[model samples]
Target: MTGLIMNERDIVVPGEKIASGMDYLPGNGTFREGEDIYSSQLGLVGVNGRFVKVIPLTGKYTPREGDIVVGKVVDVGFGMWNVDIGSAYSAILNMRETSEFIDRGADLSHYYDFNDVVIAQVTKVVRYKDVNLTMKGQGLRKVKGGKIIDVTPSKVPRIIGKQGSMIKMIKEGTGCNIVVGQNGKVWIKGERIEDEVKATEVILKIEQESHTQGLTDTIKNILEGKGK
Candidate 1:
């Protein structure tokens, strides 16, 4: 007989058995050994129709093309800036990709100085060390006067919520301009520091308790209690 050994949203460790028999199929973070399916990573269980997968609880950021990421300029070279996007490899932002006619031999640092934070889109991912980024798109620009926070990259979807409802609610409640990058970096700017702090707290709470049920209601209650 086919059966699920673990319920949906169940926390599972690596190599833990999550299902039994041939009627079930293994998805991401899972492996099939004979008739049993086991978890390949420590994460929350996700059951979608007949597919079972694990939503990782923690992991390093994996840059993908077309991902919007919040990155810091680490080094300014002849024609490009090296950005640390919370990944093992630093992404490159070429001056040509800045969407301006940059004259050759001009100081590239004038456009993007070192230590500057920017919201950029991943233009290309040739390899780990060759990730390319661009700032030509709308809403992609330098971040100023805000606090940045990091979360597990995998938990970004939960923070964004369906149709951007979760983030919209948080912004309404805290009066903060929040930007969430796919690289797990979040920037929050508010009129008051207390509002920013509250937004940060709520975001961290969602990241920690994402696997739990009734998360929407719980977050709403938290915001309401703060008179937000």
Candidate 2:
């Protein structure tokens, strides 16, 4: 008989057992255990049919199409902006994807000066792995008066929780507007600078501890303490 050692979303650290037995199958990050199997490392458990794989919950940013990300305007060209999306591959935001009626000869600097932060959407992913971004729709623009924090891209889903529940709780408790970039950059704005700082600290703490059980409850406790 084979048995699964862990369930989906269960965090396992290095040398942790994942599964056992031969009749039953194993998923990712699993190895045959002389008719049994086990897992290795700190990651979330994901089971697909007879296969079980461990999805690492903490890692660097990986580009994906249609991911809304926060980026800095690094260089402006005749009709495009080079954005640093915290990856080896930089992204391009063409003028056509910007605001309409952009003056043909307007100084791009006036629109997006170097080092300016902006919210953008990944429009296309090239064969070379380069990302194309755009900022021409609602809720996409230069961010002002906020501090940015970096977190593991893989931990974003946990921070957001199911259907935006986790983040909403944080915002309601801290009275801060939090924007999580798919590329792992988080922008937080609050009524006061201290509030913003506290919010960032809370978010970072959540990110660091998301692999643990009862994360939502833990975050709630933190928020409640902050609220008081």
Candidate 3:
């Protein structure tokens, strides 16, 4: 019989034996040497169907279609801006995609210049390895007077939680505007700097302890204590 040695979110190391025997086999992040599967990196175990994979707890961003991302303008063209999305591939924001009625003759920098941080949605994934982004939608625009934090891209969904329950709690507790990017970037802004700091701390804490159960309740207690 095949046996699984780790649970989801369990931290594992390179060359660790994940499973053994021939009735079941491992996939991605594992190499099969005869009847046993060995891990490739130090990461958390993720089981998908019969395949066991490892999600690197620490790594750079990887782009995907329809992922909401936080990015900074790096280069401004006549009708588009080049943004760094923390990926090996750079993203492009076309003039038409930035706004509904962008005048062809208007200066693109007026809308977004170099070093401007903005929240955008990935619209398309190019086959040649480039991503197209758009900013024309609700809650998508330039971010001002806030700090950005970087987290592991794979942990983003956990930080956000199912149906955004985690983020909703953080916003309600701290009264801060928090935007989570699928690319592992976060933007936080609040009326007061102290609130912003609290929000950031809460988010980082979630990122670090996402694997644990009862995270929502733990976070609520932390926020409640802040009121005292």
Candidate 4:
């Protein structure tokens, strides 16, 4: 038989027992030993029927294939660009994936230079955690005239909310264009500088208080000018 020993949303530590029995299966941030399940990281417990998982509260961002992320150009090289995507390793964006072709002796810096920000996707992850990035898909491009911010990767889902409802609220409320990256980077742009600042504050708030209940309501109140 299997049973959950911890309540959903409760914080758990590594090696702490979360469930027991073969009937239960471990999900992310959890592992199984015999009929027992234990936490593999510090995170909140989540139980769905026979499946139990943990949502991490703090950790470095891990790159995943097909994940869209915001990145900063760290260096422009001969035929490749190095991007800082908030990971343990920098990601590589090659000229072939960036465009069809360019002159052999062209200045790559003209295309992407140091300190420029962009929205990209992870196309491959090789051994030793080397990441490859691409920006050819829809809505992926260089980000100009916007402020970029950071948030914990684990809190990104909550910042997005159910079907992007939360982010939609912030955009509609402040008239800001926001792009959230899976690597914990956010880019915000608005007509008024104040709107952009407010939106950033709101996102940071959500990042900090994602585990708290009624967070949507709180954010709604903040956006409506009804709360601080």
CA deviation > 4 Å runs, candidate 3: 1-9, 15-38
When sorted by TM-score, best at the front, the candidate numbers are 4, 3, 1, 2
> What is the C-alpha local distance difference test score of each model?
0.92, 0.82, 0.86, 0.90
Candidate 1 off by > 4 Å: 1-9, 17-38, 46-53, 127-129
Question: Looking at candidate 1, what is the lDDT of residue 19?
Answer: 98
Task: In candidate 1, list every pair of residues with a backbone clash.
Answer: none
Per-residue lDDT of candidate 3, residues 1-228 (tens digit): 467877777888989988777655677677788888778877888888778888877767767787899999999987899999998877999988975678878988888988999999999887727889999788889988789999889889988888999899899999998999999999999989999999989988988898789998999999999946
Compare candidates 2 and 4 on lDDT and give the better one. Answer: 4
Best-fitting candidate, scored by lDDT: 1
Q: Pairs clashing in candidate 3?
A: none
TM-score of each model, paired residue for residue: 0.84, 0.79, 0.85, 0.87
Predictions: Cα RMSD each: 2.8, 4.2, 2.7, 2.7
| TM-score, prediction 2 | 0.79
Better of 2 and 4 by TM-score: 4
Model 3, poorest ten-residue lDDT window? 21-30
